[model samples]
Target: MRFPGKVERHAGRARDCGRHFTKTLRRAALAATCASVVALTGCDDKQQVAAAGPPPAVAVTVMTIASHGAAAQIDLSGRVEPIRTAEVRARVDGIVQKLLYTEGTDVNAGAPLFAIDDSDYRAQLEQANAMLQRALAVQTNAQSVVARFRPLVQRQAVSAQEYEAAVSAQGQAQASVADARAAVTLAKLRLERCVVRAPIAGRVGRALVTEGALVSAASATLLAQINQLSPIFATFPKSNTAILDLMDEARQGGLQLSKDIRFPVQITLANGRAYDETGEVDFADLSIDPATGAQSVRARFQNADRVLLPGQFVTGRFRIGERQDAVLVPSRAVALNAGGASVYVVGADDIAHLRQVVLGDQQQGQWEVRSGLATGERVIVDGWQKIAPEQRVRAVEQHGPGPGP
Candidate 1:
């Protein structure tokens, strides 16, 4: 139906269409190959990521709580107090002439600490002696008269009235002599007291009166202070309820109370340091304080090194008795906050859990876990700061006393 030349043109157009179709098929094949390669690469990246799991665990040192016989104790805030405190005051009226001892130094009993003006006392002593000498002279003259009158009265040469008068005069002279002797002794005593001396062996405080300061004996003129430092007393208050509770616990077998009141005691300084020396319970007041409902207790401590000072705030623990099957953890494990005391525990699954705890008396650098914890549980002592609650950790056993820093 077509011309021969038209047919040849149509055949050429058809050939060009076939060539274009072949190029489209090659491009489609190339696109499919690239998509398959991209999918395989994505799968490999996903598999690699899946092979790597959760983050590595943090390393920590933990302790497994255990039951042990520990001292059942009562804790209280206390103060360092001198066993004896003496206020050095002026005993006689005089001007301060010299300071005999250095301030803040140990002084023995009878050691002179201050010297007052002794010149006036010395003059008074001489006056007393002169009066005593006059009394002695009068006494001797009266005795001579009595002797001369006695023989004359016996011989009937002197009147009875004269003999009686002589006897009365002698008695008066004797009484006067006795009074003068007493005055002389008093004057001597006053002269000796012009030098102020320590009444007890103690540490002397700073001199209150300066040189040339006038002092009076009638009014209490404070000169200095002295406090016994060795074998000091520590006083604390314990609630009456606490005492009753302690007795009840002993009755209930929760504790075995020490029959003797001289129980062991320990002290903790204000700076958070434990005092090296130990103390003993010396006294416990039977009567309860009406204001605070507390009983006063006292302990004696030997402060040989003079490390403890009076009026220093401190903490104390009284070993009331022994307890059985009590849980204890290293002191380093406990943490305090406004919420309360708490500790971090490591589970068998290696997860950290924070637990609030009730604390009891400390023992051997360990804190008693009163409540909120169970035996055989591992508590983080060291390396607690490295991890937090719910975090995984590698727990290791602690072997030493406790953690530091």
Candidate 2:
């Protein structure tokens, strides 16, 4: 524990120098570690910044909402009817001999439809002719006697009473011939009526009487029914309110139809399909039904193909007015919910905006927008689910079904 002073001082200096060197080495190592940790933190922040980028734009097919100004269309329930209907009846009293036309077939006017038993009529005609011939022969003989008696009476060779009797007999025979000729004419007319013919050119229904059935002429017998197929009629009962509304529309210039112009009409079948044939508004009843509070409207449709039959239920449509500068969109574009109909309209900046629209009558695959849309505006039709409201989008122009309203 005890040492010289110089030796003790040198030992203390050596220990101090060793401690200081160790402390200096530790500080240098700590500084190097902190520098490496700071460099790693800077690299991590750059990686995160590179991973985060702006959202991609959604793509969609859009149709510009344009004003297809057309006459306003009103659809109403109706039924198909025949243009003309006639009841085929027996014209002469006789037994039904033959049915000339097949049941439910087309027949021309004046074409023979039924054949009645003409045996009696034929015999009566023959009898009248025979009687006329007999009367003519008698008249000729009486006339010859009268000619011979005329000279005898003047010359006093025969008695005047005998000559006068011969002249009276000739007159009686001549009168008999005239009556017989008139009877023959009547018999010929009766025989011609034995063959019943069609009264009009149309489709005939089932035959009421079979062959060998007795038909009376005095009673207009029902034989069959005929209906005109081509140019059929469709009658629709329109409510009084609707009629008044149309009149109001006309007064406001919503509808500008000509006085003599027959508005174009269309029909839809029960299967939700447009009828192949188009019709025209032909008649509109002025008087309203007190019981139903509706007016009857009629339309004429060309049924050359006979696709539409009488009594068939249909939806008749006609132009009640027009919509100027109206917005029209595809049927598929609009979406429905409890809040009513709405559509996704793409803006000029390629942003999708959800908009509510008022739906009107549906046209050819397009909906007539009453409000909430303007002309030349882009409405998304195809890609609705691609984005939500306020999301960016890529719009593309498309020529879709919205051609006419």
Best candidate, TM-score? 1
Candidates in order have lDDT scores of: 0.90, 0.87
lDDT of model 1, residue 344: 94
Model 2 gets an lDDT of: 0.87
Q: Tell me the TM-score of model 1.
A: 0.77
Q: How many angstroms is residue 365 displaced in model 1 relative to the true structure, after the best TM-score fit?
A: 4.1
- Output the TM-score of candidate 2: 0.67
Model 2, span 1-405: residue lDDT tens? 866998999999999999999999999999999999999999998888778876778789888866767657888999989999889888789999899988888999998889999999999999999999999999999999999988888899989999989989999999999999999999998899898888888999889999989999899789898999898999999899977777776787656545654778989998899888778988989899999999999999889888888899999888755766556788889998999999998888888999998998888778888789987789998889778899998888887444542
Error of 2 at 31 (Å): 42
Q: In order, how many clashes per candidate?
A: 0, 1
Across residues 1-405, which tens digit of lDDT does each residue of candidate 1 receive?
Answer: 759998999999999999999999999999999999999999999898889877899999888877888888877899999999999999899899999999999999999998999898899899999999999999999999999999899889999999999999999999999999998999999999999999999999999999999999999699999999998999999889978888888888878989999989989999999899999998999899899999999999999999889999999988877997888888878897888799999988999999999988766778888899998888898888777789999988975446433
As for candidate 1, its clashing pairs are none
